[model samples]
Target: MSYDDLMAMRPGVTFDARGEAQVLVWAPKAEKLQLQFGEEAKMLDMEPKDYGFWTLQTRALWPGDRYRFLLDGKGPYPDPATLYQPEGVHGPSEAFDLQEYEWSDRNWKNPSMKDYIIYELHTGTFTEEGTFAAVEAKLDHLVELGVNAIELMPVSQFAGDRNWGYDGVFPYSTQNSYGGPAMLQQLVDACHEKGIAVILDMVYNHLGPEGNTLGHFGHYFTDKYHTPWGDAINFDDAWSDAVRHYFVQNALMWFRDFHIDALRLDAVHAIKDFSPVHILQEIRQQVDALVRETGREHYLIVEMDLNDTRFVKPIEAGGYGMHAQWVDEFHHALRVSSGQERNGYYVDFDGVASLGKSFRDAYVFDGLYSDHRKRKFGIKADGIPGQQFIVFSQNHDHIGNRMLGERTSQLVSFEMQKLLAGTVFVSPFVPLLFMGEEWAEPNPFQYFVSHTEEELAEAVRKGRKSEFAAFHLEGEAPDPMAVSTFENSKLQWALIDQPPHGTMLQYYRQWIVLRKSQQLLRECDRNGLSVEVFGEKELLCIQRVWGRQHLVAFLNFSKSSQEVSLPFEHLSWHKLMASSDSAWNGPLEMPEQAEAGALTVAAESITVYANIINS
Candidate 1:
């Protein structure tokens, strides 16, 4: 609408007098814009501003009010800030009242940082139906497995039927096929009823390739900085305040309107802001205030590669005050210790000492010289509590971005997989289990996307092929848009009852149970955490302690049995709680006695011993 023509229309109903909610949309390109709320349309008068933003006020949109925006006096346009897209990503917005739905977890509160066992799952592929109801049925399973929280991959509306959701275009609207806004509420409501918290993964670094209309409405993107995806967001440029507000507002809406427990920010290293007060700090302050007002504890977790402890430290101590950060160093160290090839980032992490250092301080580099970047990188995360770091063996990035999307199941032996899980879960950090890792689903978690534009689709296909050329594979890279790509990635639930799958599932369940029952292992303290290297650089002994709870973790990375000596007395007489051996599905048949203060740890096996007995 022409800027002046949009200002000539007036609303039929008074909003502020009736205490109804109001909204203003800016669209300088349209000839005219009007509100299409059911049969009676309201004309909006746009207020002229320096940045060409159109303004208007409206009465509160109650539940079941179907609405759309009319541009240039033509047809209707989906709201740029739509909350629900019932018909899919291409449909009109539906007014959803948050108070209509009854919540069953009114008194339920989330577990503290020190008491979280996270389960990461992708909603689209988590179940056969790929809907909220399907995932809701599995809540009891997570609670049974002792996971306190569920971290879902980005659920924002993207352009395709299948995606990793890093390319989301609509930040406010929930994905349509995944059952939209109401379905998400139901899912969270069910989780809370089962004493499980929900943490949503959100991306603010870049928008999707298509269906992104923020640029057409106002100044959203700036050329001040550049990201690998495209132009960076204008956090410090002209009209950047509004752009920043758009994101923070969206974040608060998720917590306030939808009752989300927390939000996991994706790739914070790519976010650019050079203002006096960083955008992250601003977001932290606002969220903190919201928590105080609502009388509920909400968290903001960020995924960063900078290895700076300030991201997780408190604001009072001159830090960004985020609840936690995904610690990639732990993943890299475990992967290299398991004999993984030096791929892109793995080049900096191929030593047993690196693994030891990560276990000791939670970061392998710790400000040391890096061979990959040819510069010193990463600071020591010594004083930071282990709970502030979310550690995992494998995530979507590690599996899907690989040349063929080979999971840990395809690369390492069954024993090694269990050994790696033992190493991670027994650490002081908050442990996370990737979807299907419990049962070792054999299918590759390959990267897949569907582009609506033909040229963009071709570009994505060609780019994917070229990206994997360095791997020197023999076959053609599968088309990401093909139905087989999505179908091949689905979890084979029936596999859990098979041979190796059954063994892996039992190992995970048993380890999780031990992690819960063992007092020393449950305490997330760095003071008593120590590691003893053995097996001529192939074996490791990890010890963790909190108060009266003391645990010794034995791991042998090689394929042959080895004897690892302990530093403490009575260690020789320790009992085994978990083993990765295929033949010996349970613990060792022998007594819990050691020979001459030494323990016999099987090759590619992991065993945990509790020093303090139960009352």
Candidate 2:
């Protein structure tokens, strides 16, 4: 059957106008299938259909009813497309009704991609409660910080109570530990009401090892290729069309039912597909159609290690046509330049020069050789807009994957932390901040999981130690199965009112306000930006222009104060913002303009100047 015909089959529970619900299962290997509702309910034999599908229609199934599929009359298993896993991954799936919630965001519209100031947070560690309702309670803090969008780490149902959510077995279920499907919908609805967009991170490359039953249902996995997690998803092998439809529908469900504004596709590079039409392209096409039908903007942001522009390039240009992608080069360059430990991937990057190149070109290794990979990597992202690339100084992978889970704040001084903020916020690309980055939260974002299987937990612990050994990191890595590890990662929200933390928080607020108010600072076009490096003096001069307004930012990465020449010596410049201002408790002395012929910038400081000369 064609792809469209297989997708039209709807291989899950669907309800009609008269409240009659239909339960469908796709088990090609099984000769008989039955639907078992509740513990004492009757077992109904599903009528077999074409293309390995079995269906059973009844008026008995209603919202909140628990059911399991009995394949070949052997035993029961949770639905592969389960909407809610209230009893955990091993138990029966709970039926959920999306239409029951009374949403108050009817007139809410998502902000355009260019205007996005993304704040990425893990729902579990973002607050003390670690639930969807708890995250909703903290929305006011994000709004006050001037962030228009919040990107959540994966929330799919995983093994136990605490996990990174990347090892989720059920793609459709909202984690039962995090208040289930209704709570997730409530969080999204609340965000829209506050003029904030919600972005969900999704894993489509491979499912987690535990609680996965798709292989028994159909040819959902293929042995042709292997992923780091497990067998590759069947996107091109026999009976792969149905598998593709399953994932595609999952992506649509987040937008259609939960009202998510965008989806951050996790590690698109691992998705192995050799078909005529790539899966990413197909997702983009469907998402575009959904946007047209709903009259609301939706985006697909990818997290890829390969610095290829094909993911975000236009479809007509022989690309997948994704909206944006996370650019790690910016983070790597910033980390190394700020005197962080150089190991593993950090070996390839040169300090300030590489950072300057990223400021100008958006990619440091654009079609260049890499000492770490032993091969040339990435394509030139010259003409692409800056909004298509999301950049950050710290993220989950950078901090959580470390042996000690130390944040950038722990690695650098308070003045340097403010400098990091200035550099990230002033850049042309869309900036993303980790949960506690703004206030320099002292908690480490360690890797933690709650795997039920003892053997699997030991394997994860061994894998983590071996992985960090390659980076030459000494000491033992934190135990991933411990509850303390997850608790230690939670943000200390009360610290925001403390002395230096409050000062830093206010600095971030001012920087974001400045970014929004300035036209040249918000320009996404690379042609309008330039970066000049003074390597010997550890200084960088970045200038961005939009029409008549020009913004020049001078950053000093040295330990001692440096006297640097302004980018525009002749034009009159006004001080826009400075990281070393006394208001932020820095040691530097702020001046109105250049003294003599150069501007005297304090050690590890950033100062921005603006000039509006119509020429």
Candidate 3:
């Protein structure tokens, strides 16, 4: 069938023949569907579709048309596919001409995956204003923190102003609550200007329940596979070609249209497809082709539960060739050693052996049997360089999805926090810090959404409570609908003045300085990495060497004061880069001897000592 004929049967009005037009919606279910074009008002025909969709096509539709769909024929609803919502999430969706924005980052390209220090952040909680522009103010801080890129949480338009952004339904639209497309451009513009790159987290595995209107237009989802959220996206089922195209197009939009440096595909394990050419492989090939064509550094990162190195292996080498994946091994090992919390996956890693194994060999499980999973899980990453993995102490899911929305600080001592930070940032792997982690923001990053339908909102509130109940902390779960949920999640910028917060910030700055200044931490060769245990079950010593420079990372997991002798009998200690303590905390001091190689480290602390003598 011709494209025009196919468009006729679709529920909502899609693009015109020229692929250059604006769309209008007038759903009766919407209280109102009025169109506000920056300033002008165009009353929509709230015509109901036999398939339950309302749509309108206008020739005047061009890029930069700011408009909102009025629900109930009167209330304003952000466009499901709004390219830009200049106003925050509550405002109208604007028709954005992606071609108009001038990019000055010609030399900008994807940095080596193994050399990255990633910072994962949610737009809503990253700043008080919770807009793209607000984050622009913090670009320098991230750059100074030694992060190569900022991995933003999903930014696609979702149901409400305060969502985590994963439940987004409109894959093509920027979240209006976060200053939409134009604002996103400004953020990217500023990031490139500061020598920092942006990586967007995208969710294509499933769509949110409330605002997902794709069903009315096409079979975007199917029952062949089930995800925790709901029906899985139709990637191999009938009419799945269109569904696959939708996602592929969206992926290109972020890189080509929005000038995004990279995209972090969320939960690839949840995406089920039976096609001969896996959609992910197809995407990787396309992105690689784009890189060749444009000569811009572009990359596709995946968040895969499977420890298959195929994700990062080159496609020609019989692998997927994804640039990087988040390493849960790092998080599990460190959390097990530091927090001593043995719940869920943490059940497998409470032993010091796991921490040592993780430090020595990047993966704790490493193809071994997982008792909790009741199967042999995880593949060995010994040959893979650490930079291909994104390691972190805490992230949105680790904290926000928790029953109480507790951060790493809630579970571990302040000393351990420093140790954890050092472990991640100094390791050969790429590191990521969740928002507010730099200064330890007190706000909880919980699940929050704004739904226009009262019934949908109530249902969400109940589901959230039940979801957390499985952890046995349901009573402490914050109400999803409560205004306090959103309010409490806001970062209190004032915390920067506090003692631990201020100190931690300074500690991060020092760590970044050392990371940049030192050669050992920047080493990307897997063969150059090595580790040795100092104490059997209390402290661990890891040494990374590149060329002649050697960096010894000392980590003490125990609470009580304990000490251990260092390695390298032929060398002397040079200098201590950072410690968990400051002089103000209790006479914090560097190692006594300024010699080159061997030394002793304290308990509940992480120390970085260098060897000045050339090898």
Candidate 4:
């Protein structure tokens, strides 16, 4: 199929072969469908097409016009493929021309997977203004931090202005509260202009509960599969072709229309599909075609909790052909080593030993018995490259899902916080930083929502409480319905200039600079990497060699200084950056040189050394 044909696959306000836009709706359940235009609700009959598609080719709708669908003279509802829901999810859908945006990113090129230093942030809370334009204004902060990509959490249209955005019922429409599709266009354009790529998180496993009208139009969901949120999307059941096309086109929309560099598929393990060609593979096939046509690189990153290598492996290797995936094992192991309370999944890890194994093997539980699950979990990810996994110390889910929503910086010691940041930079994977983590912002990222229905609101409150009942953490889980919960999640941008916060910011910036400048550290080289764990001392050493160059990191996970060996070919090893150094307000004054064999690293700190010749 041509690019235009692929764009037209989505049944709503899509451009034709001649490049003129038209309204098309797919309401398989509706006997008759009509178009309701403007505030006057002027009704116009829509001719039903062959397989439940409704179209009104005669009545042309322009950008900025408000409209909705009337199924069989029933009350009006928002379009399933609405481009902009200016009046919220329950209200009328406004038309916004997706193709009209004059992009300035023509000269921009997507960065390589290995070069991706991603910073994940929610659009609603990244800034106090809580809009896409506000996020663009913070580009200078991100540019200074040296992250090449920004991963915005799901931005689909949700119930109200305040949400983490996962509750969005409309998949195509950009959240109106966050400046709609137009502002999102501007953010993408501005990000590319600054040499930054955008990775949009898309939730396709299940739609949100509020304003969920897809069932009224078509069989978009099925009862066969169950997800944590609700019923799984209809990907393999009867009338699954239209459902598959709807989502595949949605993925294409992000890449083709919005110029998104990568899509982080949220929780692909929950997507139950018994079809020969899985939904994810089909999306990849169409995206590959689009890439050939546009001559630009696009990526699909999956968040599969299963730790299945088949998702990231190539299609030729009997996999889903995904570019990369968020590997939570690294994060879990790192967190456990950093002294996070052994609760929930943390109970399964053995601290530094797990972290050490994760460095060697991509998955810590690769075909091993998982005590948390009481069963064998995760197949071996032996052949996968490190760049195929995205690792983070703290992400939205990690922080927000906590009982009191405490950030890693708040829970761990100050020294451990810096140590965690350094470890991520030195890891053999694409590193990610959650918003406000660099500066140790003390604000909590509690779960919050603005659902209008009181019953739904009460259910959310109960659900949040039930999730962390096992953790046994000392504080009451914040009310999910409270506006304060959302307000508290916003990043305190001004904290970057404060004393310890400012110092932490410098530590992160310098670590990133070091990683980017060094040849061996720039990307993962499993062939030339070695990890050693000292269980008694809680010390982990990682050695990386590329050709003739050699670098080593000594990570002390203990609360006290630990003696470590630094074997070197030369008589002496040059001391590199260290969190224990006085530059970061630590006890140790880093020397120009270090003894080749033995050294004592500071408590909860990460120190690096290079051979005298390489240094």
Q: Estimate TM-scores for all models.
A: 0.91, 0.98, 0.86, 0.97
lDDT of 4 by residue, 307-400 (tens): 7888888988899899999989899999999987789888999999999988888799999999999999988888898889889999999999
Which predicted model would earn the best TM-score?
2
Per-residue lDDT of model 1, residues 1-615, tens digit only: 453443332211213435464555655456566667764755454444434444555564545666777766755766667777676556666766555567777897988877788899888888888778889988877776778889999988887778888878878888888988888989998998898989999998888886776676666788889998889987888878667767777788788767888899999999988887777888889888888998878889999979898788888888888998898888988898898887667888865667788888888887899988789998888789878888999999899878678899999987788888888888888898988998888888888887788898888898888887655555777788887887788888888789878877777777778667766667788888888776374877887767765677777788777766655663343565657443436434434644336667677777766665344
Q: Model 1 compared with the native: what TM-score?
A: 0.91
Give lDDT for model 4. Answer: 0.88
lDDT of 2 by residue, 1-615 (tens): 443565765557877767788776778878988888976866888888777877778988888899988888766888888989998888898877767788888898888787889999999999999999999999999999999999999998898999999999999999998899999999999999898999999999989888888788899999999989878999999988778888888888899888999999999999999888899999889889888898878899999998888889989998899999998999999988898878999999888999999998888998899999999988788778989989998999999988989998898999899988899988988989998999999899999999999999999999989999879978898899999999999999999999889999999999989878887777676788888898988788888888998888888888989877766556877888888989999887677665325778899999888888757
lDDT of each residue in 1-615, candidate 3, tens digit only: 344433333222245447545453323234334454546666545444432344455666566566665554444566655566455445666676666667777666567665566788888877878889889987877876667789899998877687888878777888877877778888887888787779999997888876666564457788999998888999999767656666776787788767899899999999998787778888888787777888887788888778787778878877778888887777888887785567766777755677678766677777898988889987777667667777788888878778778788777777778888888877777778887888877677887777767998888888877776545552656777776787788777788779878888878777777766677776655576667664454777777778877767777787765555556577776665657445425225665454544344556778777776564
Steric clashes per prediction: 9, 0, 33, 0
What lDDT does model 1 reach? Answer: 0.77
Alpha-carbon RMSD of each model: 4.3, 1.4, 5.2, 2.1
Worst 10 residues of 4 by lDDT: 1-10
- Residue 231 accuracy (lDDT) in model 3: 85
Off by over 4 Å in 1: 1-21, 26-33, 37-62, 70-77, 469-474, 570-573, 580-590, 593-596, 613-615
For each candidate, the alpha-carbon lDDT, in order, equals 0.77, 0.88, 0.72, 0.88
Error of 2 at 166 (Å): 0.4
> Which ranges of candidate 4 are over 4 A from the true structure?
1-8, 15-20, 569-571, 612-615
Which residue runs of candidate 3 sit more than 4 Å off their true CA positions?
A: 1-59, 64-81, 84-94, 107-109, 534-536, 580-588, 592-599, 612-615
